[model samples]
Target: MLCEREKYDKISEESNRKTGDDMKIIVSGAKGQLGYDVIKRLEALGIQAVGVDLPELDITDADAVGAFVSREKPDGFIHCAAYTAVDAAETEKELCSSVNEKGTLNVARACQKNACKLIYISTDYVFSGEGEEEFETDSPKAPCNHYGASKLAGEIAASENCDKCFIVRISWVFGVNGKNFVRTMLRLSETKDELTVVCDQVGSPTYTEDLAVLLCDMIKTEKYGVYHATNEGLCTWAEFAAEIMRLAGRKTKIIPVASSEYKTVAVRPLNSRMSKKSLDENGFSRLPAWQDALERYLGILNEC
Candidate 1:
């Protein structure tokens, strides 16, 4: 397995050489888990990246988006802003739609007006919870929940509105800058002697830090289309929790349960397996295994 330093070096060398110096990129939702890491990665490569979120840049406002893009005049725009609260989205349908659908349209329009390439971050929820086969980039979307439906709308908007757009879908994302499963598990471990996680919900756990590197690399090329990006292995939520406990050297027993055991406002996909064929075919490097990513993430958590 390549160490984090080696991975960074490889990506930096390849992307910087391809993109060259002084390439300005605009990143929306800069404070998001993926966006934070992307900005850091770009900075490491000596690239000029401008990150915006909330009050500074309301993606839902078309005029605000157009003004920002016109002022920045960036070469590429990474649209990471989205209403990501899965369960909350069920009750807040309008808010979710406004951000994920209309907000994305606004960003796409801005990108088109500025002649900027767009890299939109998407999710695995777009697929229906069916079959064991990996969902390809072109797989038909059947959203199981409000969050998924809204994201699918965003994907469509980005594709239709922008001439140069790369819609990259990720699954089970965990990062330092946002609330995620990993952090929740660790927090729960502190108070609870045991925990129950869903075993039927299976997907790849993507580390935002690893994903950020891939996004930075993808923006340098013109391979505009849909792509599925996640760590190379698959596991259920139960298995993921077990690994996290094992790495942290915690003795908290992890109890496995079916999706029916836990009730939520929104439904989750049972199978979120996605194929990375597009990444390989397009000559982009795939992320490391989930285990490796977990270990590295744990090390970072320890430091914090």
Candidate 2:
């Protein structure tokens, strides 16, 4: 018998599409990588967008969040703000929880009050790094580290507080506006002739530019729920490092090392392979292959 994938209720065609010059959307973490691309994309599409970040907005402050939302009165809010330092999260558990969970709750409440569509960006770390099988949207969440646990809590906070929220899980994201693996690899190649990278962990790399396009598409429709979004292919860290060298014409060699050889403050998930059936079913398009994305990324770097 075929293993049946549990399906989610299909997104109906009843779209409360946001249009016109007066249309507005607010983006959290607008200074970050994904948010930068998203705001750029929105402007390209002729949509009015406002970004909130840094000293102007502290999401953990309920009053600030509420006032901001009330003032903007946006049709949609894309929440990309997060405490992303993986290893640091282990020691800074309290801060991580406050930002990822409490901050998210504040945002969700604000969104609910404004009747705004919320998009909460999450990570694949919520799963244990056990097997090689791809993780489904409804996969059991057994986060092994503090960071993962906090993010999982954030997911719950966002979903529970806001009825019109989209929980989008992504992994290995790279982009032009912020620091990412591609830039790090290229920087390392400038000095080192060889590098040892972790080979055990494998996942797809998400290009923020591509992801931003998909997000814009989602904000247009009211099909809000949980989903996974990433580039179309997968690779180990070592393989990805080697590809970076190849693209940039660097002679740096990549040596594959097991997870045990590399020590970190926090545990990492090995099985970050997420199934995109949800996106396909929800009438969303998958991102381009990682290899294609990497090449374009390097090209962009070269021009810069």
Candidate models: Cα lDDT each:
0.92, 0.87
Candidate with best lDDT: 1
Q: Tell me how far the alpha carbon of residue 294 in candidate 2 is from the true structure, in angstroms, after superposition.
A: 0.8
Tell me the spans in candidate 1 whose CA falls farther than 4 Å from its real position: 1-8
Error of 1 at 54 (Å): 0.6
lDDT of 2: 0.87
For each candidate in turn, the TM-score is 0.97, 0.93
Candidate 2 per-residue lDDT over residues 43-113, each given as its tens digit: 87777889889889999999999999999899899999988999999989999999999999999999999
- In model 2, the Cα lDDT at residue 19 comes to 29
The total number of steric clashes, by the backbone 3 Å criterion, in model 2 comes to 0
Provide the RMSD of all predictions against the true structure, rounded to 1 decimal. Answer: 1.3, 5.8
